[model samples]
Target: MGVRMRLTTVETVHEEGSWLFTVRDQYGADEEVVLVPCEDGVEAWINRCTHESQRLDTGRGAAMRDGQIICPKHGSMFDSCTGYCDNGEAAETTLPSVDVTVEDGTVYLTDDEVSYLRDGGIDEDEDEDGGPSSTSHLSF
Candidate 1:
């Protein structure tokens, strides 16, 4: 089954060079989605690191090390400029991105990708491509 997702809101960050906006997914309710700014645009992924969903809870947004947000949970480093790989640890696990488009100066995340963005989690054991399961912490 395809993952379900939705565009929730927009968040902005102030950097030395630019003011960036992150298109947040509806997946995370009390949790924050990580935003890595890039030259092409912005790379938005679920803040939860694939290795463990702990750093996201600890408020380590992008896991920055030496001004870079490397997930503290796994030391995974992504390009703050393109959301790609700085060290490339879990190549199979993509910093999952939702389909986002801008219209009228507003960003919108497609509905098809919203479910995964929710605070809910999936059984990683069953689906290799699926995200961390939040069933134990089910909030719905």
Candidate 2:
């Protein structure tokens, strides 16, 4: 296991509907990860729909119903705990997941392929400023 970097809290994930965070992949590209409440705890997945590469959470929150995350583009519902999509255009597909662990009510980024960058998606000025913004609506 690699170093676990702090992401967010379980309380915040529940209170905010969802939590979005930025991470730098092994290839040095920024990727967004969304944390949603699950039956057990919070589960983190790459913030895009599998079928169309559409963002699941568009700076607000991913539409969820009955413990499933809804794909806004195609209405595919993904199991929040398993990342599995059993119907719609994304049927039988699973959203790419970003490994995370909850400890002491806090969430940490544990995926070896990525490193925590900031608490939001790719910022508008990220390329210009060389980093993410300190605050964003998508963040906790």
Candidate 3:
């Protein structure tokens, strides 16, 4: 349902800086991909909230709560380290997560993604059935 965009190369982001990439699927929806540098190499995550499809702001979503991103809308928290969704109260489901690997200092978004059953087969995170890593779910 979303349009997948061509993966571009970014060469200036630092350790604490974030690189944003947009992936447009076939449905015209542009999924926001963010590459966050972690102590353990690099991590890839979709910038969307698991609840109401809110675009998760990299700055506000993830706060320094022992290290994780919290959804400002519903207070749903997700571990940026692993893209695990644990809203403030208890851990519920997770959003769509993309596999990331860095080579030659360039971060690439792998083809690895799970499909959400509701979106005619768009990849959803393993934990959240209908929720997408980004707006991929809403696009469809």
Candidate 4:
């Protein structure tokens, strides 16, 4: 399990929508995770779409319509609670889920593998901004 970092209180997050949040990994790297409201509790997953590898919440947050995370590119809909994509082009595929725990109204990532989708799967080379780039190859 990774360090239990506080994400937010349950009161602040609503059940009808999703929130795109970032957390640092064990190596102190920023990882993008989406916190979605579910029936049992809040669920977390990597922000990348399973079909085309695009950020699920890119332009206007996640496209959460009719209880599904609809992929903007291919319109693949994933269940917010189970990370199951049973519709659209990527029907058999599922989004990568992040380990999370909620205690005392606080949410946290509970594994050392937590991380944002790194550009090129993660490289040590620093970009011009003096920081690692989060860009990743997207197949269309």
lDDT of each: 0.41, 0.83, 0.51, 0.65
lDDT of 4 by residue, 15-43 (tens): 53676676556577676677777765778
Candidate 2 local lDDT, 42-117, one digit each (tens): 9999998898887788776778888999876677889999999999888999998989989899988899999888
Model 1: CA > 4 A from native: 1-11, 14-32, 65-68, 80-92, 115-140
Regarding lDDT, does 1 or 4 come out ahead? 4
Query: Which of the numbered candidates is closest to the native, going by highest lDDT?
Result: 2
Model 1 C-alpha lDDT per residue in residues 12-46, reported as the tens digit of each score: 32242112123334555433454444543444555
Candidate 3 Cα errors over 4 Å, as ranges? 1-14, 58-65, 112-140
RMSD of model 2, in Å? 6.8
Q: How many Å off is the CA of 134 in candidate 4? A: 22
Per-residue alpha-carbon lDDT of candidate 3 for residues 1-140, written as tens digits (9 for 90 to 100): 22222333334333334555555544656576655555545565676667776555543123334456555445666776677775553257676767655666665555434222121112434334433244221121
Compute the lDDT for candidate 1. 0.41
Worst 10 residues of 2 by lDDT: 131-140
lDDT of 2 at 86: 100
How far off is residue 50 in model 1, in Å? Answer: 1.5
Poorest 10 consecutive residues by lDDT, candidate 1: 13-22
Report lDDT (Cα) of residue 32, candidate 4.
68
TM-score, structure 4 vs. true: 0.70
The candidate scoring highest on TM-score is: 2
> What is the clash tally of candidate 4?
4
User: Which pairs of residues collide in model 4?
Assistant: 31-115, 31-116, 32-116, 119-135
